[model samples]
Target: MSTPVQRLTAEVNGITLSYLSQGEGPLVVFMHGFPDLAISWRHQMKAVSDGGYRAVAPDMRGYGASSAPDDPALYTQFHIAGDIVGLMDHLGEKSAVLVGHDMGANADWAMATFVPERVRGVVVLSIPHKPRGTQPPVASAPPRFYQKLFQAIGVEDDDLHRNVKTFLPAIFDRLSGSSEHGAPPSLMVPEGKHFSDLFEPPSKTPEWLGEAELAEYVATFERTGFRGALNWYRNIDSNWWTAAPWTPGHVTVPAAFMIGTADVAWALFKDNGVIDSQKERVPNLLDMRVLEGVGHWIAQEAPDEVNDLLLNFLAKLEARDS
Candidate 1:
């Protein structure tokens, strides 16, 4: 039998955040990426809770049932990190193990960098921490990078919102490494085309993502247009500017990074020494695990493997503490 996962709300950083939690022990907060909800971490949450730790996964500040601040500027790394810290305060926890995926991994890097003391250990999935680069991301990235397309406001949202159902599944299929779907490596929208115009309708949802699961994501985006989520992308350059002062900082806390071999982000960064560069940027990085034949949606696609890695990391931390 599985323990029931509870839905709860917290007043953190002057906003309401909806989250899912299970068990009642040391804090292990999971932060999910864009186009995903707290439920995305259900497998990990249950695994951790069953292992005698309290596990929590928040919908983040601007997604799902959480309060979405209209201003794009409000979605910076500083703001997102503050919300996680505030969540700790609300839960009366002095410190916690922070686990983040995708954009949430970016926030995990920020939290571990800016407020090292509050984070006992850190785990980032899909995205690795790259210290401030010489040039702006948009300029430095290849012309085909999706982040560039995402930077343009209104355009991406219009296409995404216009074809929510088709667009969402297409993204999952393409980004996933499932041989069944045969998705491409890059998700770049054509130069003169809309974002939704790039993908053909998926014949079926990938094994990692079921129709029921995709429906949940579709319903959320349908209720709350893609504006809030897109705002995260809009602030990319601004976040780069805000992080200038912390350029010299490194993730001093114990950290681990994991990514799927087939992840689009990894494919782009791997050639650029991004994965190897973690040694200098995250000096205390404990491990870097690359799962073969996996894709961007790692947690959902390989929950058992992800949970095992997380548990192994947690066990190491516990042994050290004891």
Candidate 2:
């Protein structure tokens, strides 16, 4: 039987963040990515909490029932990381094992690097910790990265908003390795086309994603619009500028990085030595695992494996502290 998750809210970093939590013990906070809610970690939350750790997954600022700030500047890495710290303060905990996926993973890397003392351990999924490069990320990529496309503001938002249901399901299908929903589609969209153009109408929801879950995501995006979430992407350049001081900085805390073998992000970063470079970027990286048949949504696609990895990492942390 799964532990029942409690829906809770707190004033953190000047925003009201809504989160799902359960269990009680050492803190383990889960941060989700774009187009995802706290519920995205439903399986892992229950698993971790049941394993004797207090598990909390927040909807993140500008997401779900959380307060959405109009200014894109508010979504920077500094602000997001601060919110996590503020959450800890609100919970009366000094530090936590921070776990993040996708953009959330980026924030985890930031928190560990910016305030290593506040993070007992770090686990980042899908995205890797890439140190700031000399040129803007947009300018460096051969084909413009999606982050650059997102910087266009209204254009991408219009496309996504116009086809929320189609877009969401399509992305979920395309990113996964399973052929249950048919062959995954290419994510690359041509300059003149919308990102939604890449995917055809999905035949059926992938086994990893359910109709009810997909409906929930669609409803949330319909209510919140893509602006708040897109703002995070818009701040790419600004984040680069703000993170300048930490140019040579590395995550010195115990950390683990995981990604799926078929994840598009893997393709993007593989050429850049993303996995191989972790030794230098995260000197204390405890483990790095690439799931053989998984995709971008590792936690959701393989919840049991992800839960096991997390529990094992936590156990190792406990042993180290003891």
Candidate 3:
């Protein structure tokens, strides 16, 4: 059974964010990434909340039931980070541990950089920080690279909107460690092919996903469409600019990074200066784990391991205060 979550909304940073919240005690915020919802953290929320922490998972600025401003500009790093800080203020929290995955990892890292005081600590999954590049990210990528393609207006959204169930499950399944289909989903859109052509949607989703859970994901996207979420990709270049003042700023808080070795992102983070230098960059980095055979969906794919890591980090934070 899924954890029973209290659905709530907060008016933050001039927008309303619908979030899933469970349990009580010290605050712990979970943020989801692209094409994901707050419920992505359902397992962790229940575990952390049971361990005596308030678990709050916001749908993020442009996904799920949250505010989805049409302008791509609103999805920049500052906008998303402020939404988090503003949510904290709305909840009357002085400081809270932030846990995030994918785009959420990106946003959580931004929060730590801009407002470390409001952050007790951060736990990020999959994505490790890459140094900001000089030109717009899209400038260097080939036209069909997924991120570059998303920069153009309406193409990807229209493609995905045609078949949410098919494409959505393909995303979850193709990137999973237990995926029956071999080879990770390609991010490049080949000539004469749309982004959704990356893989055929499996009739059965990866084991980690439930039919009901997937239904909720499909329904939400069907109603909201993908423009708002895809807009985040659209603003990558602007986000790069907005983040300039704090280009090399460090996260001055206790932190942990967890990823499955099989996650597609491992190709970028593994043995690269990203992890080794992350400790130097984020001086308080306390844990970095590479769980073998796991996949991109680290939290959902390996809940038991992720729960242990989250609780252990939370306990360590409590000990520091003691």
Candidate 4:
């Protein structure tokens, strides 16, 4: 049996962040993306912890057990980088390896850029450290892009709120490698359909996600609503503005990146210049793995593979540090 993860909270950045921790040693913080909670890293946390490295996954600013701010403007990258650095201060640590996926990945990039001294190394899944374009993100977004659709605000929340239980599971199924969900439609929103309408709910829970595991997410969203999460997207343009001074700044720390071939992010963002220019920007990027058939839910869809990759990276990180 695996060691049970401990639940803890840190009062940081003027808010409380509930985080899951396992193992003991140097700190490694895992951040989850939109539509996901800290538990999303349950698999990686265990593997890395067992591999003899501390793993910490937090319910980021607008998700799950963490406090969610009401104003979308509060979700900027500046706030994100601060929360993480503050979390480290709360834990009394001076440095850590940062691991992130999706929105979590975005925050990791920001933290690495904003506070390089605090990062020992970095691991990112799905999203690469794409340098900012000259134009504002929202203004430059593709037609009917999901991120664009999100600017409508309350559109997705109203749709998903209609059937939290039914719609929530679909996102997991359709986003995983196991799903027959052919090329994901433009992420956030390609056709301008309601968030729930864009996906077909699975007939059964995905193999990687247990019904009980899914129940937790459903219950959480059902209670918290998707406002805090959607608010992240609402502030993309503002994030670009805050990111202005740091645009083109690369993550100089040792880094690794992984993405599933079937992930919707790959299909939608492949040509957006993030993946293409990842190497030029993230110079220390040591490993880049492409999981042949996995999707956005890399940790859940292929836990064993993800675990091995994380352990390998952690080992390399320790070697580099020592």
Top of the candidates by lDDT? 3
Candidate 3 residue lDDT tens string, 1-322: 3346799999999899999888888999999998899989989999987887889999988888999998998888888888988888998998899999998998888898888899999999999866776777777877788898888778888988887879899988888887778657667889888878996778796779898899999999999988989998887888777788997777879999998877888866677667667876888888888899888889999999999899999988999999
**What lDDT, from 0 to 1, does candidate 4 have?**
0.84
Candidate 2 lDDT tens digits, 155-188: 8888898899888888888778774554445555
In candidate 3 the C-alpha lDDT for residue 19 amounts to 91
Quote each prediction's TM-score: 0.95, 0.95, 0.96, 0.95
Q: lDDT of each prediction vs. the true structure?
A: 0.85, 0.86, 0.87, 0.84
Stretches of candidate 3 exceeding 4 Å from the true structure: 1-4
TM-score order, best first, reads 3, 2, 1, 4
Model 2's TM-score against the true structure: 0.95
3 against 4, candidate with superior lDDT: 3
Q: What are the clashing pairs of model 1?
A: none
How do all the candidates rank in terms of lDDT, highest first? 3, 2, 1, 4
lDDT of 1 at 295: 87
Our model 4 lands, by Cα RMSD against the true structure, at 1.7
TM-score of 3: 0.96
- Give the alpha carbon lDDT tens digit for every residue of 141-217 in model 4: 78676777777777876777777888888888887878766655556554646767778887888878898889999
Query: Candidate 4: misplaced stretches above 4 Å?
Result: 188-192, 271-273
RMSD to native, candidate 3: 1.7
